[model samples]
Target: MLDHDTAPTGDKTIETAEDLSSIAFGFMASKALFAGLHVDLFSALADGPKTAEDLAKAIGVPLNRIVMLTTALASVGLLTIGDDKKIENSPAAQNFLSKQSKYDFGDYLRYQIDQQMYPFLLQLNAVMKDDLSEDAIASYKHWMTDEEQASVYSESQHAGSLGPGRTLARKVDLAKATSLLDVGGGTGAMTISLCKEYPELHATIIDFPNVAEIGWRFISEAGLVDRVRYIPGNAVEVQWPGNQDAILMSYLMSGVPGDDVEGLLRKAYEALAPGGRLMVHDFMVEEDRRGPALAALWQLQHMAFTPEARSLSVGWLTEAGRKIGFAIDDVDALIPAMTKLVVFSKPA
Candidate 1:
C-alpha cells in the first residue's frame, strides 16, 4: 500500500477516497440532470434569471422543492446562482437543454435516458448474467414494432442526429455523388443534411414504415422533398435500390444484430455501382479496445437490449471491408471520441 505522496507518478489511480466517492456517487449527478429535464427547469430559466420562488412559480413546483433541485443543478454546473440568489441556465444548459434554442436536445435526453435507458439499465446485471426476462429485454426490433414507441424514438433521434448529421456533412466530401442511399436512415436527418450540403445530391432513405412517416415530415420541413425519397421496409429484408454513387449507414452497424452486420455490408457492396463509396458510421472502439470509454459503454448499452449485438472496432471494420473487396479510403472519428466514420470503395 502506497501513501498518496508516494503513489506511482505515471499511474492514473484514485488520488483520494473522495475521488472514489465521486465515482460511486456519479449516478446522483445523472439523476439531478434527469429531474431538471423532467420539470423543464432549464427551459424555465431560458428567458432570464429568476429568484428561487419565481422559478418555482414558473415551473409550478413548490418553492422549497425547486430550491433543492436548483441547488443540486447549480452544484453540478448545469445552472448558476448569483449573489442576489437568482438562478439562471449555464451556457451549455441554455444552448442545448432549453427548448427554445435551435440546438435543443432536451427531449432526446429526456426520452433516451430518463424514459428508456435508465430503466433498461436497471436490469444490466441480470442482462450480463443472462437472467433478464424475455419480455423485459426489449431489443430495437421489438421497440420499433410499437407505433407510439417508434414515434417517440424516431422524433427524439431525429433531433439528436441533426447536429451529428451536419458534422458528417462537413467531415465527408460528397459533392460529386449525385445519388445516395441512406440505409436505416431514421427520420431523414442525415439525408436532409447531405441534401442541404450538396444541392445536386438526391437521396433515398430506407427504413421502417413508421420511421419513414417521420422522415417525410422532416424531409418536407427541410424543403428537400424533391431531392429525397423514403422507402419503407425492413432494410435487411427489402430489396435495396442499386447502382448508387454513395451509400451511408450511420448508426446502423451497431444497432443491428451481429449476425446481420456482414449481410448488410454485402448488400451495400452489391447495391453500389463500381467505384461507389460506402460510409459506415457508428459507435466503434479502437482496435485494442482499452479505452474510449463512451464508445465502449454505448456498445454495452446496445448489448443490454440486443443480446446478439457485437462490439465494433476500426480494426474489424477495415478488415471486413477489405475482405468484401473494398478499398479503404478513410477511417476517422465522426462524433469526436464517441463514434467513427469509415469510408470504403468498390473497385471500378
Candidate 2:
C-alpha cells in the first residue's frame, strides 16, 4: 500500500523536513524563549546549575512545569541538562540572557517581541483576508496616545536599540560633531551612546511628550543629562533645531506613512548645516522586496500593525537624499541583514 501522506525524497528528505518543521513551528521556539525570559530562568541559573525541582521552588512554579520548560529550553540550546540532572545556562544565555549580565536583552525580548509584536502576528491571516491597510490590531498612534503604553513601548525599544546604538557608536566617527538632532529618538538610546562616545557632542532628542519623559530618565541614568536634552513634540510637525553637525533618524521611517518619508528626509536635509551629516538607520529591504529574510519578515510584521508601514529600500533613500541636496557618504549594516545605517552629508 502506498502512503499518500509521505512523499519520497532521496538524500535531502531529512534536512528538508527539518527545515520545514522549524519554519512551521518557529512560534514554539519564540514562545519558549519568551517564557524563559519572563520567569528570569537564566538569571536563576546564573550562580550555578540547579535541578529542575530547585528551579521550580526558586521561581515558585510547579516542578512538573519547570521540568517541561527546562526540557524546552534545553532543546533550544539556551540551557543544558548535565549528568547530575541539573540545568545550567549555555554560555550564550549566561552572557546575553541573564539579568545579572550587563548585555541582558531579556526585557527587549519580553516587552517588544513577546508582548507587543507577538499578539499582532497572531492576526496575520485576518489582516490578509481583510486587506487591512491600517493596523488591524494596536495602532502606533493609539499606542503613543496612551501614557502607560507609550512608556512601555519607549523603554522596550530603548533596550532593543542599545546594542545597535553601541555598534553605531563604534563604527561611525562622531568626533567632529558638536551638536546632534535625533529625530523621533525614542528613549534616547542612540543619543546616549553617541554622546558617551564623543565628549564634545551634545544631543537633542525629539519625540512625543510621554516618550520624551522616559528618555529623560534614561539620559539621566546614563549620566549624560548634561549633554542630552529632550524636545517633546510630534517629530513631523515640530521645528527641528537647525544648523546641526549631525542628525540621526533611526527606526522611524518605516512606522509612518510612505509619503511622509520623503518629507522627513527633506526636513533632515534642511536641518543640517553645510557638511553636516545625516544618518538614517532602519530595517531596509532590497528594491525587489525579496528575501533578506529578516527584513522581509519585519516588513510583514510592521504591516500587521501599522497601515503606513513598508520597508524602505536603500536605493530609494539614496535617490531621495540626492534629490534633497545631500550626497550619499556611506551605507553600512548596523545589524547584518536586519538593520542598516545609510549616511548622507550636505555639501560644505
Best by lDDT: 1
**For all candidates, what are the clash counts?**
0, 0
| RMSD of each candidate relative to the true structure | 5.4, 7.3
Query: Candidate 2 at residue 347, lDDT?
Result: 98
Q: What value does the lDDT take at residue 246 in candidate 1?
A: 96
- CA shift of 14, model 1, Å: 4.1
Q: Report RMSD for candidate 2.
A: 7.3
TM-score list, all predictions: 0.92, 0.91
Per-residue lDDT value at 302 in model 1: 85
Q: Point out the worst 10-residue segment of candidate 2 by lDDT.
A: 1-10
Query: Residue 234 in model 2: shift from native, Å?
Result: 1.8
Cα lDDT tens digits, model 2, 102-128, are 988889889888988888787677666
Taking the tens digit of each residue's C-alpha lDDT, what string does model 1 give over 1-348? 111121122236678989999888988998999899999999989999999999998889999899899999899899999999999999999999999999999988888777877777787787778887867754676778778878888998888999989998997898889999999998988888988999999999999998898779989888988999989988988999999999999888888889899999999999999989999989987665564767888898888787778899888887888998999888777787688888889999
